[model samples]
Target: MVGKRQSRREAVSEHKRELILDAARQIFAEEGLDGASLRAIAVRAGYTPAALYFHFESKEAMYAEVLHASLESLGSAVDQAVSRTKTPQQKLKAAALSFFQFYAANPRDLDLGFYLFRGGMKPAGLGHDRDVRLNAALEAALRPIAEAAIALGAPQERANLLMVDCFAHAAGLLLLLHTGRIRMFGASAPDLMEAYVDERIAQLVQE
Candidate 1:
């Protein structure tokens, strides 16, 4: 009975932690990291500021967790898209499209990923260690695209370079989309992305 009660308490604690992280994602999207405060997150999560300390060491910790989850979710979507297609060319296209669609569909997530709404200068990340970890997550999410390129007969260096290009293009398009600038170009981000992917695939494979 004691063990059962302890397990129940742990489950409740975990639920609270998730709530905190959910609130953090939304708030971070709206305010960015420097603009967001522990009090704000705790208030949004319906807890006292002190209550947050029980679950997280600091706001940076929560930001890292939120970003990690966001990147992992993106990686999963890309992986699933890759799996759904048969040929390497198709897989490469699917991976890039999935990356764009993930951010385009969830503008809040894109904001969170880019740390939007900062009023002043912002470092690339919380610090060196956090940046390394976060970049690794970002890299893992984009790795399958390079892997698909390699499958299509591109050398490792070229495939990796192409993957970086895809990331740059996708992220730039997504930024234009969120800022309502894509309409000025008279082309949908998806259409532009498809054209880009089709050209890249053609360059690599004879199909």
Candidate 2:
């Protein structure tokens, strides 16, 4: 009977926790991290601020949790894209496109993942370990894409460097496109990214 009561309590606790997180995610997307107050999230979750304290100690921890899920989704997209392709070239293209497209389709996720809404370079307050974990999540998401590049015959060193270069350019282009500056040049974001992938692959093959 005690075990049964404990299990029921745990289930209720988890449900409330998820409800709080869902509220946080929505507010973070709408208001950005800096603008999202713990009070607001708690209110949105229909819980008192004190009640929220039982689940999350701080907003930074909550932000990290939300961003972790976003990165996981990114990693999954790359994996599925790679799985669909046969050749290394195809895998690389697929992985790269999937990575870029994931952000392109969900601009809000980009804002959440990248802290685009924060003014100045204020720290996210996630602490050292959480920061490292978030970085690991991002690197894991890009790993498969890098592996695809390596399979195309580039050295591991070069493949890692190329992955960084390609994604850096993609990120900049994506930000510009999302902010409407890219259209000032009258070039499409997808077309530019596709062209970039082609150029990088061709260069990799040549080198």
**Candidate of highest lDDT:** 1
Q: In model 2, which regions exceed 4 Å deviation?
A: 121-125
Model 1 per-residue lDDT tens digits across residues 1-207: 999999999999999999999999888888888889999999999999999999999898899899888889999999999889998888899999999999999887787777533454444566677768888988988998899999999999999999999999998899888899999989798899889988998999973
Q: What lDDT does model 1 reach?
A: 0.88
* Full-model lDDT for every candidate: 0.88, 0.87
- Which ten residues in a row are the worst by lDDT in model 1? 115-124
State in Å the error of residue 92, model 2: 0.8
Spell out the clash pairs found in candidate 2.
none
Clashes of 1: 0
Model 2 over residues 1-207: C-alpha lDDT tens digits? 999999999999999999999999999998888889999999999999889889998998899889889999999998998898898888888888898999999897888777633676664446788889988988887887689788888888988987888779879889988999997999999999999999888887787
